[model samples]
Target: MSALEAVIPTPQVIERLPGASFKPLAPAYVRIPKPKPELQQEAIRIADLLKRNHGLDFQVAVGGTEQPGDIRLEVAPVAGVPTGKEAESYALTVQNGQLTISAPRMRGWYYAAQTLTQILLRSPEVPACRIRDWAAYPIRSLHVDAARKYFPKSWFIRQIDRLATLKINQLQWHFSENEGFRLESKKHPEILSKSYISRQEATEIIAYAQDNHVEIVPAFDMPGHLGWLLRNHPEFRAGEGEYLTRMLDYSNPVAVAFLKELIDEFSSLFIGQTQTWMVGGDEVFPMEWIPKELAKRTPQLSEYAKRNLGPKAEVLDGYMYFLCEIDEYLRLKGFSETRAWSDLLYITNLMNLPPRMQIAYWTQWSELMPSTQKLLERGHQLLNVSDRYFYYVISNRDDCAYKKHVEATEILRNYEPQVFSEKYPSPVAQARVLGSSYAIWCDTPETEDYEQITRGIWPGMAAMSQKTWNPSVKVLDEEGFMSQLYLLAKRV
Candidate 1:
């Protein structure tokens, strides 16, 4: 025997003991010990998957049964589930021809289902074993730039399922950029498109994500990536000429208010019991003021900007102040967790920033461990996306951003958690890491090669999932990972 094995993000513990094993799942009926609406729906989804993959009539049973095809689910906390950190831990025991999964939370049970589904694909039979598993980071996020380019509705839902199988619990919805805003709002009817997700469709996507154990963290990059929005509403744009730059005019109070209104709309749709919001404060390299040198003359604006913000009240300072105001406003409007690019902390002089807003540290090909350490020192939690490692590339090189082709395997192996661990060895340092989210940016919506993109998402996403789930993890067996990938493809 090749020893007891599990798929990507190999389990924490797997012990084999001599006993009767399930030769096959045995025409099983999946049952829940108690009525859990979420648990029942997840069980049904996985059972339906098993039926499709292996031609097994794995019926979904709501309550316990002693019949032959019995796979009972029990809910309870893992003996030592972490209190301070979010825990997605579960225990599965297969003994005496019965398989039972126990979890402390609904998410745990759903993850346990994913693990078992993979095991089934390898063999209908499971050795008499006990497996205990939990995620290393509370947030394993995947970022999709639907703002720059849009994807089909089915694409997002299928992606939710695929990400869940890899145990990614969050989807960072980057739905606004310079190219387009891929959401429909009655207030902003001018920007609506045939391809945009309607209000009704957005609601459906949210529901689908919840059922599949995923949280959608929605984002609309402000101030900078607003070419499309500013083009439509030229009064809000920063620079002017026959060829006006697309950046939003930060010194323009009307423009600042316009961005806030968009945030209000974004919050109304995304904020529920558990959604998060982010304002992108990245790549504001050019210092563009609407009036060119308005701050140099306006004492009131420059005084507030200089006093509350840093001392040097320049164009960039105004931009930072504007972002901080929006951040605080979103926080006041019930978004306790506001996120922005780590550049807000690294490059800008924006002081008295909302310390509570989580930072997503991503910069291409630059060593950000120091930046992450800096953020941690200031008591800020961060998600280590570190763009170079998590970015996905299209084969055709047809997108506006990336014109060169990159392999999915390279993207998969580009990152490791060791860098951060080595940099910050203390317990406090460890906890400040929110988790990692890989970005798959698409700048041109029209010319995407679906096959190439889908292939990249599967194995590459699997690699990211495994690394973030267990930061110390490495590809020990190439063949084993490939085998796992094949099975995962069937489910995806």
Candidate 2:
């Protein structure tokens, strides 16, 4: 196989060099311009990969003079290299028996290291080649719904390792749901589930993700999917009645205030870790969730709508208004961007959501959800979490509970980030799309073990990484890709 096919996500440009293949000697050296913390970390990562994959001991060094057989990583503004957000671009050249990886940022170098390791996994003698690579989208991500089913901290670390290997850069940790709240909550101790990741565990997870050059996008779904929280504080229920819905009662001043305070408390943990946060707004009202007799059945919602959203506003208007308030509050708290599932926003024609609030376009199964064009026309940036292409709802049998198991092999062969939905087929413009995300929603965590879940989603995640990085590039067929995967199974 050619060197290009050796890597999982095929490089953007690869051309064979006219010389002998480069081979690493024992006690090889990984040299960086300086021993800065970021540079040192990357060098060590590359060294570790070499040692683990090929059993070739590589020593990390600083400011080394030229050597015959050595790997050099540098970050600078090369004339032809991509700049700005696409700085993840990198150029790896193997010539004159030496290897070099150059980019404008640390992320680029990290990706280059992964690519190099893949090539080495194929053979110690890497075919002389020049590869110029960059992601088509800036936010390739893997989102895990850790709330419904509590995954151990080790599970997260293992996935992060695989994510790094595939060059997937973001992990959307959906840590809250109706069944449970995964993150430790000191502010509301009563809301804690029987098993949840503690504050210290989260800190370690975030730090480890950082080491792997992955950013964790903390997701604390709100207003809805709060069965655990509402069980503790029943006053936050949206409607009256002893059992009422778990949705937050926006009409209650105390509920809204408590939501904001909770947001503040959780934001403290992820303050400097990330600038993107997800306040889930999906399935707020299951069927008939929007009471037809809003005035009589949900007078508080009707009143809240009239008070905040104009007179003559309906319950749908009230829901939209509440979401806007959350979006605005997150902006005030210094989050550059806020994301929510694309259920309510698409149902209404009201373009109330601020442009800063990105829409996670997951499904268009229901006609109520608007087309991709309408969302882009609204000037809202979209992250393609298309359920058809990206969702991996865990299930054991053919008749899964949520949806059929993800056709990972088919996705590896024929999926692209721009295919937002299966029913309403429209190719989203590359510029408007932030990137694509592969969601692993554990509807029934007991259905599969952690190993089974990982095994099932590995292909889908790797395919997502390949397609989002450079969708136009030709890659190995499924069989060839699997062979490559098996060779690099223990890379991380």
Candidate 3:
């Protein structure tokens, strides 16, 4: 196989030079370049793996000066790179028995390491390749529904390691909504009655991800899909109804204050660490903004509007009101932008919206929810997630194991993120497409030990990566993708 087919999300440029090779280790021990103590972990990490995989020992040492040698790792600066690729772009060279990877920042270095790992896995003895690569989207992420399953810290750390291996950089921590909340808050301690994720534990997760060049964005569903947040505190429940599906009552000044304080608490924990915070305003009943459960059973008007009722303007007032407050708070709290479902725009006419609000937007491929063009015209930046391409959806049934689940590879193989550009009118609006993500909602029984959660996401993750990185999917040959998958299977 050619060197280009060796890497998933196929590198932009891969040139092979005959009779070129990189001997990663000597028979006795490889004289590895020394990384600074702060970065020594990565050096030892790579070296130890090479030792285990290819049989060599590295003499352990702590601090040492870094310089060019058989293997060189660098952190360079590419200024004013709003293109979203340059910051993480890197060039790798393997020629004349030497190997080197140069990147703009620490994260770039981490991604370079991922590419190098994939290389060594295939050609551990004498690898021959030269490549320059970057991603099409600035933010390629995975959203894990930890709130539903209560994943352990170790589980998350392992997943982080695996994601970084794929060169997938962003890890969106979906910490709350529906069943239970996985975030810790002193103000709203009840949210963590299960203690799914503690403040200290969150810090550890953040630090580990940062070390691996993964940005973990913290989120807790709000306004809609309250989960159990309202069962205990009915004060937060929207309009009096019999339906168990409760959403935050935006009309209540007290409820709004409660949400603001809750957000402030969670925001303080994640501030300064990430640019985006997900204030979930997604999937709220669109028409009356009430629980759909009641409509399923009761056919009434005043029965559900939750006291916040009126014409278009008034219907949107309560929901938009909290969004306005949450966006401003997040901005003030060191978050550069906020992400919400594109559905947030559906309730009210796109006449006026907080221009700063960004969207984690998607539509059912067959039945696109928010019009891609309309959302763009309304002037909202997007983290495009076409449910067809990105969502590994499963029946919410407690027993819905992958029995009849659709293989995501089928949809993703033909899907590309660049199609979003067509929906935008101009280059300016097109640029608003920030990146894209894939999500796996809980589909297993609460007591199940979590063996089936990754079934749908695994192979599909690589496909999504390739589509986002190599947006021109049609140009890619089928043989190349199958070979890519074959190589990935061995490592995964």
Give each model's clash number.
0, 1, 2
For model 1, name the residue pairs that clash.
none
lDDT of 1 by residue, 319-388 (tens): 5677778877887778888888865354334443566878887642233223555666566787877555
- Residues 282-363, model 2: lDDT tens digits: 7776545444644567778788888886776877777888888888888788787999888767455543777778899887
Residue range with the least summed lDDT across 10 consecutive positions in model 1? 418-427
Better of 1 and 3 by TM-score: 1
Error of 3 at 369 (Å): 4.8
List model 3 lDDT by residue over 1-492, tens digit each.
Answer: 554466677777777766557665443322224446645566556565445434555543443442222456655543333465787787777766566666675566656656766666666544566677777778778988777668888878877766776778888888776777777777777666465777898889888887777888876777777857876787667555533246776656787788778877777667666888888877665434233433443323222233434433334444566676777877888887788877646544523557677777665322324566666666777886656556665455655433344454564555656454234323334467777787766644353454455444666776667767756444346566666666655554
Question: How would the candidate models be sorted by TM-score, starting from the highest?
Answer: 2, 1, 3
RMSD of each: 4.1, 2.2, 5.1
- lDDT value, residue 244 of candidate 3: 29
**Of models 1 and 3, which has the larger lDDT?**
1
The all-Cα superposition gives candidate 1 an RMSD in Å to the true structure of 4.1
Better of 1 and 2 by lDDT: 2
In angstroms, the error of model 3 at 263 is 2.3
What stretches of model 2 exceed 4 Å from their correct place? 78-85, 240-244, 287-296, 396-403
| lDDT by candidate, in order shown | 0.69, 0.80, 0.64
Best by lDDT: 2
